[model samples]
Target: MFGWVSGFFTYETTKSVVVKSWSVGIINRVAQLLIIIYFVGWVFIHEKAYQVRDTGIESAVMTKVKGFGFLNDNLMDVADYVMPTQGASVFCIITAMVITANQTQSKCHEMDQKFKCKNDSDCESLTFSNLASGKITGKCIAEAQRCEILGWCPAENDIPIEHSMTEVEGFTIFIKNSIRFPLFNVTRGNIGENLKTLSCTYDPVNNPDCPIFRVSDILMYAGEDFSNISKKGGEIGINIAWVCNLDEHVDNCKPTYKFTRMDSAFKNSVVTKGYNFRFAKYFKSEDGNDYRTLHKAYAIRFDILVSGNAGKFHLIPTVINVVAACTSVGLATVLCDIILLNFLKGAKQYKAKKFEEVSDSVSRSQSLDLHECSQKTIKREEKSSDDSGAYSIGHQV
Candidate 1:
């Protein structure tokens, strides 16, 4: 009875030890998972976003920390391992929902068009003749379909922005030619990545008297991957500047121009590429000093660049070899096909000639036999008639 009691106690002790070990193992796993989740969500995703923002256009970036989606595929390693618990899954879902809602609001605001220009003639309203002195004030009565005022510039007649008009003529021509080009069909949401045209107005904020020139149909490509871009992709910067040339236009003054870059700064506005320099104020061209015109107009362009090192060596070498080999094979095939076609045509002509010769020989033989038979019939008829006439005379005697 004592032995039995001891055995019962030992079994209970073993069971408790087993339960404690299992509980410890589970806790360790959960802690490890949580740590991994926090690290990846806080570090890698934010780092990538910051890098994207350093570039000069507005950008909406969405990174998934939860279930599988486009960008979440990249995060699957950590997310799947950590999200097994009900609490973790719920947390990730909440985070994704908040991000998505913010994206919708941002997108809705961006899609709201804010600028209007009735027609191309409205572009002429951007002349310096319409600017107000001291307090910049001007207006062009030109009508436009729609226009959004992004920013304005102010310039002093005495202190002109430097080098703003150096490439005025060329820049003007580019603007005119750009009109001939088609408007960029920017996608409205996260479905596709593209740059949308934003209206830029250059009127002095302090003084409302300035001629506002409108840049229409500016071309810009987004620098974000499709999965990373938000439904409301982001805003494009419309940089503008008011630059005056003091030297060439002013009597007895050294040639110089005052220039300033202007644009609206918004959240998610920075992308991987630098901001557009179209509206940037800089001295351009040292020669040919007509600095007073202030006829320069500018636009922005955005380009996205993607860099990765996976399969670098194998991919490049394989592609190079494939292209070289394909070109060679294609050229050889084309040449061989041409040669074969020509040979086949020659052979057919040779066969046709042989057939024509045989036909000609048979026709000639048939014609010769027909002529000989006709001649023999004619001679036989003549001889029979003569013999009959001679027999009749002998009978009469």
Candidate 2:
């Protein structure tokens, strides 16, 4: 109980220092140097360890495409080829189209290759599947041996049409982008000047600042051909990246753009062939009858994707990184101590000098008391022996 009470209040501490060796010193110095390099080179210079980061970005984009071509021997303008006419941030221009003109609400004609039947039971009063163009009426056109669907009178032609817009090679798209870092209170725009962007084109080596890009150039950058992709539509992606260091001047912050083709090339397979969609334009005849023209438009889709991150100096991160670097330095001392006490020559001697057993005041007092008790017991035994011998001699006399 006494020993436990003393131990509860007392603690052991070592006070010896080992004579340092060249090998140990070298190892420690190397460890310290590595820590210093990591803190200064990587954390401070490269990663900006003193700064906090904010990636929240606010962005807006405006895009416009310009081109001209000949469609079916008719001169076409940008207004004729571009969808929605007014243009949007994301838009497409038709490179190929299948036009079905002058149609009214009537029975849809069936293709000879798709629908085949022998009698009315095979073609009449049949519910069409979801993939069917329209609902079938209870009438079979025996000549075609197919069901009639109550839809646009004349069915759209499925004949293959190969139209190419090679003239669109020189077509250019103007992209205007503005980005803001709310945390750092910094904002940047791709266009430095209105006239500069209007006249220049995006060229990595020569005119990188220009926001105007040629469609053909973009296709080429993505390892695609304009002539080949024009026949069958595809998707193109435009990526704008902004990495800003708030410590520098705001003007230095600029965006870099990348182009990639999102869709695979044509593989001559019907399932994964190309991208196309159908739209209709309705017109009223002089007799007040409704007529429409259906157009299957195939065009390259452009998707503009924006992303960014911004960073600025802060005291909290700096302090945290500094503390981590200092802690790593202490690890070097611990490692060297392990090597000296366990691996080096004369390690046992060094261990004995380095570590010493310690005792509390209570333990010392208890040890002294035990020694005194043992000495008193030995003296009592010797005196009893002498008394026994004297008593025996007296009795004999």
Candidate 3:
């Protein structure tokens, strides 16, 4: 009698909250099971039972269900009769379950980190891209370069010692790249819960953008060649290429370039920790590879920076599929329940045995009446011959 289910079937907001917190792995299964169960219970035990009954002739529209094989028979065999009446109910419940389950599991979270070079030379410029629509888009905004004097040089005829005329230096190029983030367990307590942006700056030597143009922009001509014998930092090398605008059919322009590389000098170049750079390179290749490839191949190293809490749970598509399956099962269960109730009703068949007995008696009485009529005809014929007194005597008697 703990049947508080009548109007007591409350929506569990708490359940929804729990579901949201639940990882993508189990959410679908939970939702699916709930849907299946709810429908099966409702259709067979609750809704189906309430639907079948006989009140009065005028109010007996509900009696249409009675034609479904006496309601006393097994529902499985007699389900055909009731299916027509209950079909819509079954469909509605199924639909409702699927919709609710999907709605409950649709939230997801993502973290996107981005970096940009300080200037064009430091970045890859003039990228020609063919989009999905077959249209070409030009990238790497072109900026006008001007010669600025760093200081009035005592010696004449020397190129102006401007602050690296192409201020394209200080770029942190990462070669033989590798990126490592604490994979939850790996970081253990070292990792923080929040998200933050970290920035680090490095000045590449003889710096590529110096007053004098360098032939190998791809090569790092810095005074401090930082190469380790162990190569612990992964396969390391510097590459330089000029930006080509494929769509414009231009191979190279007035070559003013910048230089940057990722080494120990920066405050926070450990990329995995959070700080990184998105840079541009000159000269894409026949291999159809670009700076993006480098990013994927190797991530810039930088310090780890955590600013805020990244909630732990992520909802996956599989979870939704599970919930849908569960809902479908639940609907099926409800249909089964409805069929069961119909079966029970069919089992208790309407006993019209009295009508059979009365028909039999009437048939017997009809036969006897026919025999008596034949005998009366015979007597009438026999008395006809001596009709005079006989007929009168018979009448008087």
Candidate 4:
């Protein structure tokens, strides 16, 4: 019972062992230096583990386009080429158009001049988008093999007329972007008040900070041919990334622009190759018959995409990473201990000193205690027999 109680109350403490050898000391110090270098150079400095990062950013963008071009011996300006005319982030610049003027609501032949059919059964109702120029009556006109459709009369001949707005290549696009990091409560913009926005145009080396961008340069950056894309419309993506390190001056945190062809995958497609849309201008005749001019415009679409993150030094991250770096250094001891116990010349002696445990000494002490008890019992019985004439049952006769 006493032994069990003593064992229950036992407290085991770590024994510190220090080797005074130069070789083992150098190995231990080198391992610790390597660990310190890894933590300080890679984790703390390069990885910026001491900073708290905020990826949740809010953005607003506005864009404007300006250019002039001559088409069919007629001069046109921004109003004539740009669609929506709102100067929005996503806008279109018209390159070529198919115009069908003076269209009145009446039954007319189907659009495809190559479509020849003698009967209504050969035609189907094309009320779907891109297919539905007009409502098909399912009756083939006897004069031509075209199906009769009731909607816009004198249905638009969607034949491409080679009208090149090549001057659009020299057009200038102005972008204004503002972004805010809600966590850090910091806001930044792409434009600078001191720069000359009027004459400046974007170039990677010579004029990077300019808010104005040329159309051809943007296409060049995207690795697309200006002449080829101008013939047929295409979609382009403009990416503006803002990466900030709050430890530095806010002026150093600027946006980097990237351009990519959004429809590069379908650029080589045979059918759905480019971007186009349709709209109409309505008018009323003297006889009150509603008439309109339909236009199918092929245009290049510019979609501005913004993304970014900001990071700042925080006390919590700094303290936590610092403690982790310190704790990681202790792992060097384990490596050095392994090398000393198993790989060194005096490994046996080092092991003896490192693990100074004595199970045999504990067993010897227990045996000594048992022996003393036996001696006491024997002495007590001897004394009792002398006094009261007692004898033990196991005594030999």
Clashes of each: 35, 0, 47, 0
Candidate 4 lDDT over 93-122, as tens digits, reads 988777789999888887686555777666
lDDT per residue for candidate 2 within 1-397, as digits (tens), equals: 9979876896676454545467777888898898889889998899998989878999998888876788767677887787766556678877888888998987875653455556667666465644445676656777777767777867777667676666778889988899888887888899875344277889988887898999888988877787777887888888899988888877778888888887765536677776788899999999999999988887888888899998888999999999998888888888877877788775666666666666667789988887878777978888877443221111111
Scored by Cα lDDT, where does model 2 land? 0.78
Instruction: Tell me each candidate's TM-score.
Output: 0.15, 0.76, 0.12, 0.75
Q: Specify the poorest-scoring 10-residue window by lDDT in model 4.
A: 388-397
Q: Every model's Cα RMSD, please?
A: 40.2, 13.3, 37.2, 12.4
Q: lDDT at 115 for candidate 4?
A: 51
Tens digit of per-residue lDDT, candidate 1, span 1-397: 9979755554211110111233334454565555555445553343321121111212222222222222222232223322223321011111111011101001011111221245434423532322232121122223323322222222212221222111111111011000010122111122112213322222234312221222111111123322222222222332221211221232211111112212224324544322211112233246733222221211122111111111112344445544554454444433433433354434343233222323446779988877778776868878776443221111111
Worst 10 residues of 1 by lDDT: 172-181
Better of 1 and 2 by lDDT: 2
For all candidates in order, the CA lDDT equals 0.26, 0.78, 0.26, 0.82
* Model 1: lDDT to the true structure: 0.26
Per the 3 Å backbone cut-off, how many clashing residue pairs does candidate 4 have? 0
Worst 10 residues of 3 by lDDT: 91-100
Q: Quick one: ranking by TM-score, best first?
A: 2, 4, 1, 3
Best candidate according to TM-score = 2
